[model samples]
Target: MLDSETKATETPEDHADELRLWLRLLTCTTLIEGEVRGRLRERFDVTLPRFDLMAQLDKAPDGMTLSDVSKRMMVSNGNVTGLVERLVESGHLDRRTSETDRRVQVIRLTKLGRAEFRRMASEHETWIADLFADLTPKDVRELMRLLAKTKASAQKSAARRRP
Candidate 1:
């Protein structure tokens, strides 16, 4: 009795389970991310993007090029530039032209920035631990195993879709 459009819009019973699982995963991710964002803003007065940038720099003691940071953060150079400007202005980061390549700008966290990041990271770990407190060790391990498989499957699908 349904029209073509109506039938197309409807999910058959076979696909319902996959759709529900996807929704549940998305919901959990959103909830956790929201809580982390709020906690970071309230406790550190810092945004997630800035925290992520600093975390990347923390791993690279020597510093990283603007392009490299942009790639690692999976954002545009402009975004990284703005964050770099603010952090430099706040004395939390140091930026300089690469001696070998004048056109390249390398950035690294300053002593102040490193200290602040370490402090924030320590607290952030605790917050994450608290968030997963309900999960038992076995549950955590199982989730990790399943998520790894999921990630591989997703990556394969993405590669197939790419030109």
Candidate 2:
């Protein structure tokens, strides 16, 4: 729930270095996501969910089914349906039944949607770069490497938790 300007500033004295590292990673993620959400809303009048759905479609020009989007976005199908409806109404996307399967609703970004996403994506990159401007190239590379390791560890732990 922390905003971009806020972070996990309170830490117990007894916490281990791993705990501190996790908190730092979480704080950075929250800050960046919050900022990106705000910027997308302010500049494009769009919510992060809608923007993210569009991003998925942007990557797959062939389009995706409603359920496919739901899986990819880790959201409910109903959630994606509403966003798809709004985007379609705004003429930013097009939806049609799949040729082979009439039950499947395939969604894709229109030309206008592509252009709009490009604009937002360009600003998004600049915002991220600015946020990390304090980090030197070496620092960035080291962080990237470390984060990759952390990600693998987390994924392994998560897999172990699954039934």
lDDT of each: 0.93, 0.89
Top of the candidates by TM-score: 1
lDDT of 2 at 64: 92
Q: Write the per-residue lDDT of candidate 2 for residues 49-135, one digit (tens) a residue.
A: 888988899999999999999999989989888999999999999999988988999999999999999998889889989999999
For model 1, state the Cα shift of residue 69 in Å: 2.1
Off by over 4 Å in 1: 1-13
User: Which residue pairs collide in model 2, if any?
Assistant: none
Error of 1 at 138 (Å): 1.4
Q: Summarize candidate 1's per-residue lDDT along 56-94 as a digit string, tens digits.
A: 999999999999999999899898989999999999999
TM-score each candidate: 0.84, 0.79
